[model samples]
Target: MNTTSKSKADTIAKLREKILLMQGFKPAGAMHKRITGLMPVEQAFPNQVFPLGAVHEMISEGPEGAAACGGFLGGLLGTLMADAGICLWISNSRSLFPPALELFGASPHRIIFADLQREKDVLWATEEALKCEGLAAVVTELNNITFAQSRRLQLVVEKSHVTAFIWRKDPVYLSNTTAVARWKIAPAPSISEPGLPGVGFPHWQVELLKVRNGIPGSWEVTWSEGRFHTHDETVRKLVSVRNDVQKTG
Candidate 1:
């Protein structure tokens, strides 16, 4: 290559690096990387992985599915809390027992749980909590969030650089949003421990239905040893592309 051509390429590379940093991406080798809660998931995006500083939507079709979603979120929270920051969890009502999170390395003391009964209150509280850059992450459970509402949440997260997790329970309908990714999780059969009579660890089928700047994929993930380990299930992925109450009952 000519000297002038090489110089142009270097200039372009530098500009891209600066743009990625402005977009909240961290330098990862010659490419930019986003700190998604899951490592395998981070790899799925290639150059544009899911970013924690954006809203992520999760939905399940039935009660069992909801259980799986909740289980996965627990592990997600564990990953984010490694930096020792406060996390806000806003929901219309409590579903899972607080003690269950102990296995995921998140002590109940580190979480601020708020019960917002009204739908409006839940949305308002979620938005407010996400705007606080001091918090590590914000999780909220709601029935519906339109595209406009989700865009608003995204704006706040972008400015504050905070992650937002939205759990939609028994949603009436599913639609696109400004979230970096949308997921659907269903409970898979538990893996039995060797030489034990009882079940070993909780497992779930995770389908990344939609990811704005990453690949969509599916995997069987299990929670054991305080972290998520994806089974060698031949990660089904693509380039681009809800629930009932009584989730665990």
Candidate 2:
């Protein structure tokens, strides 16, 4: 490339980084600081990294779907809080079981749960929590959120650099919002070891429905050993068989 072309390219690259930073993502150079267990899934994002300090919307249709979504978020929270960080969870319904978080590697004590009486109260608490730079992340449950409300949350996080996750269980309407990404998580059959007893690890069909400046895709993932794993049927079967043979021998 010519010198003038190279100079222009560098300027454009820097501009893109600045834009992403404003949108709550670190630049390409800082890709190492990303949520773990999101391997190929992260490739769909701009610079192959998930955006922190922004709002992420997750939708679920039924009770089972909501449970799966909560479990998945818990798994991510485990990593986010690995550094002794604190998180706030605001919800009116109080469907999430705080004790269950231990299965996903997050200590229930590290998350402060705000069980409000009204949805508006949940939203209010979420916004306030997002504005707190001392918090690592904020998660709120609501049936719907207006674009303006989401935009305000986005602005708060941009300045505070705190990540926010919005879980909409059985939402009446899915409207346009300022959320950086939209996800849908559904319950999938748990993988069981051969010759073993009852249920196994939690599994989910994870879908990235939409992302700003990124690709949308679907993936089957499981929460095993306290982390997210891109589920592979073949690998599971082989491991199960191998373990069973060893037990028999």
Candidate 3:
């Protein structure tokens, strides 16, 4: 390409980055530096970065699916908490085993879990927690969420820059939400080495059902070596993305 053409391309790229950043996406350059484990999936997002300062919605079929979704979220939490910031988990019917999070690289002490009996209480706590700038992330469980409720959460995160994950446990109807992305996770068979005796690494079939301005696809991801490892059984291509978890001094 000629110099004029090259200059024009660069200008457009820079402008695009600025627009994406304003829309709550990190820059393309930052994606390579900060994203871990899910590079290919992350590329499907605008600006090739995970959407921070926004809410993500996840739905599951039953208890098993819900557990799988939680495990997937655990991996994300590990990365988000790399800076030593605390995470808040609010749920109405909580079944997560906090001790098991060690397998996903999250310290149980860094997570504060609140179990409430009413959905309203869970929503209230979740919204209040998201408003706290000191928090790294917040995960909430709800059977259903309205567009307005999700929109409110999105607005709160935009100002606080805290990520939020909404877990919809067996909702009867899937309605519209203001979430940036919607996901569904199912338990895939575990993988074990030949000499290993116990259950192997946690495997999951992740489906990106809906994303605001990104392509939707499916992949199998495994949590091992303190990071996410993406691979497909049929293709057998293993992609190890950069580890962005903050290192302690």
> TM-score: which candidate is best?
2
User: Where is model 3 more than 4 Å wrong at Cα?
Assistant: 1-18, 28-33, 194-198, 232-249
lDDT for 108 in candidate 2 is 91
lDDT values, one for every candidate:
0.76, 0.84, 0.83
Worst 10 residues of 2 by lDDT: 27-36
For each candidate, C-alpha RMSD in Å? 7.2, 4.6, 7.7
Judged by whole-model lDDT over C-alpha atoms, candidate 1 comes out at 0.76
TM-score of each model, in listed order: 0.80, 0.85, 0.84
lDDT of 3 by residue, 156-178 (tens): 98889888999999988899998
Model 3 whole-model lDDT (C-alpha atoms): 0.83
Tens digits of per-residue lDDT, candidate 1, 1-249, equal 699999999999898778767766655653323333356766665354556677888888677887778778878877677668788999986686778776777766899999878989998998899888889789898869999999899888878888899988878988778887788888876665434567668888888888764689987777877677776533222101001112432
- lDDT score of residue 47 within candidate 1: 52
Q: On residues 1-249, what C-alpha lDDT tens digit does candidate 2 reach at each position? A: 699999999999999978976655666564245556778688878878777777899999899998999899998888778789898999888788889988987889999988899878888888889989998778899889999999999888888888899999998989999998999999976767767878878888899999998999988788876668885667567657766776998
Clash pairs, model 2 backbone: none
**Cα lDDT, model 2, residue 12:** 100
Task: List the candidate 2 regions with Cα displacement exceeding 4 Å.
Answer: 1-22, 28-32, 232-249
